[model samples]
Target: MPTLEVNFLGYRIKSPILVASGPASHDVKQIPIAQEMGAGGVVLKTVVSDKFDYMRYWPRPRYKLIDWDKKMNGKSQYFTLYSYEQAYSGSIEDYFKFVKISKSTSNIMIIGSAFADEPKDWIYLAKGIEEAGADAIELDISSPHKPGTMQFETHFIQAIKSVVENVKIPVLVKLAPGPDVLHQAKVCKELGADAVTLCNRLRGLEIDVESQKPILHGYYAGVGGPWAKYYNFKHVSEVYNEVGITISATSGVLNWIDALKYIMLGATTVQVLSAIIVNGWETIRQINEGILNFMIEKGIEDLEKIRGVAARNLVEPDLIVRWSGEKKSGPRNVFDDW
Candidate 1:
């Protein structure tokens, strides 16, 4: 029988489908549930430094499912998960306790996540997470909801470097999905980061046209949906080919197919959040079973065999073959003039 196991950050995890660090993973109670449901690992909810303690308290109605009524083939699988939630909603000490209890209760790999503005705080949080027995640490410097004026070059670069130098456990840096992903991924590799989570949610605003105002907290919120996987896929592919670093894909994973797409495009692990929150925890088991079934159908024994296959085969834009258009046709397609 084929297995879903894969090695990430020098640790063998049961599956590549990790529960992303969001509402599903913010509480210690969710850890055992994730493990029981067949998650490879879980990036614990990000603990923020006291400098951004305001993120701890969320609005009364922070989540809104946009385009929920729109459906295709009788399924509403596409929708934007708009929310204003940030940080672990707990004290830093409480976060350490949460990680410790999670590690004790579940055998699943626990990757601690944290956000801070200062390199010293990053080092301090990483050390505390390591002491709490986390398998790895992910620096969440790319959160769409991050406050203040912290730039990657000035703030996050030093934070990543400091944390990597200080932490004994593997360190993963999470970056935003933007044009600079390739450059940032290379920087992470040079800084000795064990892995890079390709892309976090984007900062977006939804409008309540009826009221002529923004929706959900009346401010720009972290937004992601099934459509997000495509850009993240591109990020993973580019980072894999150019930077050659371990990639943990996050954002827009709605099902096993989405997870498999990330794996094929060079992500060693795929972190999922919106799907679980929109669907249920059973989505974890479903994703694992789906991958196994696919492997059996294809007679593939290991994930490594297919990892980065799609990325390696990416056709350069200059080499793309286009129709000569010697034979003209009516407006059947826009490429008739090509």
Candidate 2:
């Protein structure tokens, strides 16, 4: 009733709530249920260049995530047991088929999440997704797990440029949180991306110190928790401060407060995972309802009004005037003698 429509490139979504790219969006059957549960849109689990790998398995292509804490809803690290490039992802036939079906009925857009082997492969992936009838293509450049799975900001610019060049449809570059995020967004915009999904899973590790074994089959995984909320907001604020880019805020968006904080920090939409895994899919409706009610109470009608309201509130050396704050001591440059 609150009219929560938002933009995904040129396309329109019923609300700002989206399912983050994960195990939840593997096949066609899950699509209907996700929509019924009030998902504004659902990004398909990343499609890699290796269509042969996907062909070996049907709708239930399986991957495992390591529990950092090994506790449900507890502190954890999630890494794809199996990984590949998402841009040129999956069997082209099945990827196209999923897109065609998802966009047919519901207002929810089918965003194909793609990772490619190299720059040349991006255009094929983007054009393929657009031709396949997806509303948009989400280039997953920021994800921690890929064929090489290297540091995020380092390779992001090249990845964005390649994807934006190849596709005529709206291209969304998912970026990780870091000092370089603002520059990365500018690069995406300059290269002609429509939107930016912020803060990919942060790198973290879990060791079985007792057994002296590694918990994850991979070296490290992305960290997720209730604690990630503030970090997400900070990253979003930085992007909003530097320029206006359509942002999909991610990480630990667990409550209405966390969602509102992101909106105030200029996120166009908020994606969730850990909460849905913990509470249930119905949480979307509740989150939507809560956000809508708060907006009305605070005199917010549209999504843009609250974007970056907290940008000026960010902590900076210039902003802190308190004399009681951490006082500077003498420089410990004793190594100068060496």
Q: Name model 1 segments beyond 4 Å from true.
A: 324-338
lDDT of each: 0.91, 0.71
Q: What digit string (tens of lDDT, one per residue) describes model 2 on residues 123-211?
A: 77677789878878888776665534544445656767777767778888888777588888887778788888988776555668887
Checking candidate 1 for backbone clashes, the offending pairs are none
Q: Compare the candidates by lDDT and give the number of the best one.
A: 1
lDDT of 1 at 76: 74
Write candidate 1's Cα lDDT for 1-338 as tens digits: 88899999988999999999989999888999999999999999999989889989999699999998899887777898899998889999999999999999999999999998888888889999999999999999898988647778889889998998898899999998885999999999999999999899999998977999998688899989998888888999999999989999998998899999999999999999998998899999999999999999999999999999999999999888655656455655757438
The weakest ten consecutive residues by lDDT in model 2 span: 79-88
- Candidate 2 matches the true fold with a TM-score of 0.81
